[model samples]
Structure formats: structure tokens, C-alpha cells
Target: MKDVKTRAETLRRTIGHRVVDGKDAAVVTVSQSYPTDADDLWDACTNPERIPRWFLPVSGELRVGGRYQLEGNAGGEILTCAPPKSFSATWEFGGGKSWIEVAVIPEPGGYARFELAHIAHPEGDHWETYGPGAVGIGWDQALLGLGLHIDTGAAVDPSEFEKWSLSPEGLGYVRESGNGWYDADVAAGTDPDAARARADRTIAFYSGT
Candidate 1:
């Protein structure tokens, strides 16, 4: 198993807002570098069969302009697809529509840098109640799973991940990830005090403490 703290610390996150179609939208960006080639990393993320091994099981048509759904998760239409590099899609969940883009960039020494950006409407209530951690933490966990799978070439047990999320080490990782997003929000012009408060709530929700 990987050291939770070290892995969590390695993740980079950014929480910012942008105006899309004249509406304010919040964006959460998570990025990490994996020890693999870009093509291999791209295959792991885009190939439906391989995705389930690391992330969630995905079904339906997967090509550009095709609709796809992750089992018990989000459903959306693929928007942009550039082989071994990037893909953008609409993320529809909880009766709301958002946007997601994933990019795999080649780095030196055969490392692949994975980046994901999730953009959605600013939640007046939930955003203040939980801040970016609600989303950032989720992505952080997914990135962790992906990194582990890539490094070890093994399927991560979903049940074990669920149980780990409640463990003390996992809770520590959650808190740290939440704090990272809180800083990002502050840097993006959010009130520091407000952001910190929401981060506290988010950490509590994920840690169950």
C-alpha cells in the first residue's frame, strides 16, 4: 500500500471561478504525475474495460459525441477527443449538468501527468456549506486510486477504498486535501474565513468526525 499522507501531499489542486455563458461557474482542477507513458495512461482512462479497474465501470458509447455512463455514477456526452492527449465531456449528475475535461501530458523520464478539471455552477448553499472539498476530495480519492493502479498494475478493490476513506489515515488525507482546496479558494478571491469554515465542514463530512 502507498503512504496515504505522502501521496495526498503530492497532489496539486486549484479552485477557481469562471464565467461560462454569462453565468458564474466554479472550477476544480486536480493534477498529478504518474510513472508511466502518456499513451498507457490515456488508455487506462479512456478505454472502458480498463477504466473499471481503476475508477468506475463505464458503459454506453464512448467515442466523441457519444453518450456514456459510469455505473452508479455520472452520465454525459463526450465532447472533445484527441488521442493520447485530452478529452472533454459534459458531466450530468444529480439532475444537474456540468463539464469535465481530462488531459494526459507527457513528462520527462516516461512520466505521464494527469490533469482533470470539473466545472459546474456555483452552488449558493452547498458551496458555502462544504466548499470545494466536497468535489476536490472526491477527485483526490480518484486520482489516488488511479495512481496506485498505475504504479502497481493491479486493480484497487472498491470496498477497500470505501473502508479506507473512513480510516484515520484516510481521514488525515481528506483533511489535507480539503485544506488544499481551501487555500486555492482563498487565492481565487474567496473570503479566507468563510473558505476555512466551509473546509472544516467538508473535512468533518468526509471524515465523519
Candidate 2:
């Protein structure tokens, strides 16, 4: 298993807000480097069967302008696709429309970097209540699973994840991830007390504590 403390310190997380086309949106960005070639990392992310191994089971046409859905998760339209490099898509879920983009960058020594940005326009009180950790934690967990999958070439079982999340180590990782995003929010100008409170709620939601 990957070291939790190492990941918490190594993986990069950023949060910011923006107004796009007259609509305000919250942006969450996460990035991590993996020990794999760019093509392999891209395939691990975009391949239909491989997705569920790390993230969630996904089904869709997958071509540009095609629609796709993650089982009991987000569904969206594929906006753009560039081989072994990047992809952009619309993220629609919980009665809201958002956007997501993933970029794969090649590095020296056969390593690859994955960067993900999730943007959503929070409707009334949502941002104050949950903050970025609402989705950021989920993405962090997905990234962790992806790292494990790449290192071991074994799919993560959902049931195993459930039990692990309740363990002390898992709970600590979840809490730290939430707090990391909260710090990012504060750096982006959110009130410190408010951001910390929201982080507490996010941690509870994910850790089920």
C-alpha cells in the first residue's frame, strides 16, 4: 500500500473561484505524478474497463460530443479529446451542470503526471456549507486508488474501500485531505473560521464519523 502521509504531502491540491460567462464557479484542482509512461497513464484514465479499477465504472460513447455516465455518479458529454494528452467534458450531476478537464503530461524517466480540474457553480449556501472538500476528497481518494492500480495492476474493490475508509489510517487520510482543500480555500480568500468549519463537515461526511 502507498504511504498515506507521503501522498498527503506530495499530491498537489488547489482551490479557487471564477466567473465564467456570467456564472460563478468553484474550481478544484488536483495533481499527482505516477511511475508510468504517458500513454499508459492516459489509457488507465480514459479506457472504459480500466476506469472502474481505480475510479468508478464508466459507460459512454467516449468520442467527442458523446455522452458518458459513471455508475451512480456524474454523467456528462465529452467535449474534447486529444490522444495521450488531454480530455475535457461536461460534468452534470445532482441537478447541476459543471465541467471537468484532465491533462496528461509526460516526464523524464517514463513517469507521467495527471492533472484534474473540476468546476461547478454552487447554488445558494452550498459553497459555505460544504466547500471544495465536498468533491475534492472524492477526487483525492480516486487519485489514491489510481496510484495503487498503476503500481500493482490490481483493481480496487468497492467493498474493500468501504471497510478501509472506516479504519484509523483511512480516516486520517480523509481528514487531512479535507483540511488541505480547506487551506486552499482560505488561501483563495475564504474566511478562515468558515473554511475550517466546512472542512470539518467534509471530513465527517467522508469518514462517516
Candidate 3:
């Protein structure tokens, strides 16, 4: 099992937001380096069977312009696909449309760097309410699962892992991540007090603290 520190390091992801076409959208970016070929990393992300082992169980045509759904998660349309390098998709959920992109770049020693971004809807006061915490926490968990799945052909079930959110270690990580986002929110010129308060509520919700 991976230690809490290792998992926490993976959770040190970033969140960015902006208004696009008069709508508020949040983007969550997570990156990690793996000691695997770029082709293998790309396959793990794009392959249907392998994807569930790391990210979510996915079913779709998989080609560009194809529609796909993640088991119990978001469903979207594939926008672009460049094998062993990059892919983009339209992520639709909660009556909003977002975009996700994944990029894989080769490194020395048969390693590769994988980066993922999830862009959220740009509208309403939702950005202020849930922008940072939403993307930050979610991607943190996703990256953690990805690291595990890549190293070992196993994944923590989403449902079961959600329950772990209430554990002491889980709550601690949530609080820490929320605080990190709080800092980013303030630096981004968002109202720090409001962002911090929102983070508090979000932490409470996930951690049951």
C-alpha cells in the first residue's frame, strides 16, 4: 500500500478558472511522471479496459467525434485523438458542458509525463462556491488511483473510495488540499474569506468532519 505522504504528494494538483464566452469555467490540472513508455501511458488512458483499471470504467466508440460514458460518472463526446500523445473530449454533467484533455510526453529512461485537465462550466456563482474544492479534491483522488493502477493493475472502486473520504487520513488530506486551493483562490484575486468558507464546507462535506 502507498503511504499517506505519497498519496498526498499526488494530491498537490492545481486548479485554474476563467470566463469563456461569458461563462465561468474551472480547470483542474494533475500531472505525474511514470516509469513507462509514452505508448503504454497513452494506452492506459485511452484503452477502454485499461482505463477502468486506472481512471473510470469507460465505454464508447473511442474514435474522434464518438460518444462515451464513464461508469457512474460523466459522459462526453470525444473531440480529438492523437494516439500516444494527446486526446480531448467534451465532458457533460450536471446540465453543463466541460472539456477534458490528456497529454503524454516521453521522457528519458523509458518514462513519460502524463497531464490531465478537466474544465468545468463557466457560469453562475458556482465557481465561487465550488470551483477550487470541486476540481482539486476530485483530481487528487483520481490521480492517486491512476498512480496505483499504473503500478499495479488494480483500482479502488469509486463507490468504496468515496466512503473512505470520512476516514481521519482522508479528511486530513481533504483539508490540506482545500487549504492549498484556498491559497490559489486568494492569489487569483477571488475573495479569500468567501473561498476559505466554501473550502471549509466542502471539506466538511467530504470528510464528514
Q: Estimate each model's TM-score.
A: 0.96, 0.95, 0.85
Clash counts for all predictions: 0, 0, 4
User: Model 2: how far is 20 from its true place, Å?
Assistant: 2.5
Cα deviation of 199, candidate 1, in Å: 0.4
Q: Write the per-residue lDDT of candidate 2 for residues 126-175, one digit (tens) a residue.
A: 77899999989998888999998999999988889878878888888897
lDDT of 2 at 85: 98
Candidate 1 deviant stretches above 4 angstroms: none
lDDT scores of the candidates, listed in order: 0.89, 0.90, 0.75
Q: Write the per-residue lDDT of candidate 3 for residues 1-209, one digit (tens) a residue.
A: 35655566544356677775677677777677877889888888888878887678888788998999998888989999888899999888777788889899899988888888888774677665665776677776676677777777676676666666666777777777777667766776678778788878777766755
lDDT of 3: 0.75
Clashing pairs in 3: 23-122, 24-122, 24-123, 25-122
lDDT of 1 by residue, 1-209 (tens): 56878888888888777998789998899999999999999999998878988899999889989999999999999999999899999999989889999999999998999999999897659877887888899999899899889988888899998898888788888988888888888888889999999989988888877
Q: Report per-prediction Cα RMSD to one decimal.
A: 1.2, 1.3, 2.5
Error of 3 at 27 (Å): 2.9
- Candidate 1 has an lDDT of 0.89
Q: Residue 183, candidate 1: how far off, in angstroms?
A: 1.8
Q: Model 2 Cα displacement at 113 (Å)?
A: 1.0
